[model samples]
Target: MSKLLVKLVVNALFTVPLLLYLSNATPFQALMASLSLSILAFFLGDQWILDEFGNAAATLADGLLAALFVGAMGTAYHWGLSWSALAVIAVVTAAVEFGYHLLLRRWDVRWYS
Candidate 1:
């Protein structure tokens, strides 16, 4: 399998357990926070995988898509059919992820070599 696929699988494996734990602790909101954090981490660390494949955009796109799909799954699992709650979760996740990236960029933190 390709490196990007491997990365996504690994990330999902790590995320699911973490989400489970968080869900147990704070319920659905914790799951949303976990997804946000995972996406931020993946985005910050994407350059290393991109350099390996020579396709930064592709790697980033895949990561974001995976994040959204996972986010939706988590939302569904935790919030059920509550569309309004799901919408709030989505917005908070995006905001947190974007804020994380912005802070990293402002600090000039090079997450990936």
Candidate 2:
């Protein structure tokens, strides 16, 4: 749980700022997007995919997921976000996620096991 919280915070730190800068998301919208991405990434990328596929694959999955998620959100909300902007957000978030995965491995959290 605590580890998940850390993931959420780290993801939010990167994602919220990018959302605000790259899209027309308000503060609340940005926060919600960040939180939603964080949780989804935690469960899907971190827990399931990481355990099975390791860091590199999980990182890639997370990045793609972020791009799809943000792109969808942008469309739904009329945020005027471009594909290039979504790519930037995904890359940055993936970089952060890579380091975070390293940290998790180093710390040996292994909650599921």
Candidate 3:
């Protein structure tokens, strides 16, 4: 539950602004998309990859998955999606996620087994 809370907050803090300030998404749209992506990342990146391969590997997976996720969501909303833009977002998000994982370690909090 704590982990989920972190996911919600962190994802919202980053994604909401990115979508709202930088893209065409409304606040409600940003909220929905952020939560959706956070849950998906928690399952795939934290659960499936993090335990097995550790932070670096999991972070890499997160980047790739994020690119795909943001792209799909952008398309769904008819935002002007582009590879360059998505790549930039992916890099920034991945860096933040890497730090977030480190914070989890510092807090002695594990999101998954």
Candidate 4:
């Protein structure tokens, strides 16, 4: 699938649920925040993933970025402080990513190696 399409679909899927569950704000606010963050994540994350992964980086990046964006948005919205939310998101994302890498290493999957 095209990267743009993947981003759109993933963003919607991620954002909708987060907005529904975490944010006390209106749906539009949640949607807007989610969309904006998702876009930023897609752009930055695509490059990071490509540099880290390879040919399959697009797919991996899409999923990772979507998760990170949604998590960040939810954390921020729930906390009602931009800085705190960002910090939580970054910490959580790093932990999750590290855990994923560790899992891959333990499985001896050469993909991340």
Best candidate according to lDDT: 2
Give the candidate number with the greatest TM-score.
Answer: 2
Which wins on TM-score, candidate 2 or candidate 4?
Answer: 2
What is the C-alpha lDDT profile of model 2 across 1-113, one tens digit per residue?
A: 98899998999988999999999999999999999999999999998999899999999999999999999999999999998999999999899999999988988867346
TM-score of each: 0.38, 0.94, 0.87, 0.46
Model 1 regions lying over 4 Å from their true place? 1-79, 109-113
> How does model 1 score by TM-score?
0.38
Report the lDDT tens digits of candidate 1 across residue range 1-113.
24334444444444445444434324455445455545554654444443344334434444455456545665665534244443443444444334434443444444344
Backbone steric clashes in candidate 1, count: 0
Rank candidates by TM-score, best first: 2, 3, 4, 1
Per-residue lDDT of candidate 4, residues 22-98 (tens digit)? 44657877678766865665466544564476434544454556456655655666634344444444444444334
Q: lDDT by residue for model 3 over 1-113, one digit each (tens)?
A: 89878877987888778777667777888789888888888888877787778899989988888889989999989877678778876877788779877876777655453
Candidate 3, residue 103: lDDT: 76
Candidate 3 global TM-score: 0.87
lDDT scores of the candidates, listed in order: 0.46, 0.92, 0.81, 0.52
Measured on C-alpha atoms, candidate 4 has an lDDT of: 0.52
RMSD of each predicted structure: 9.1, 2.2, 2.7, 7.6
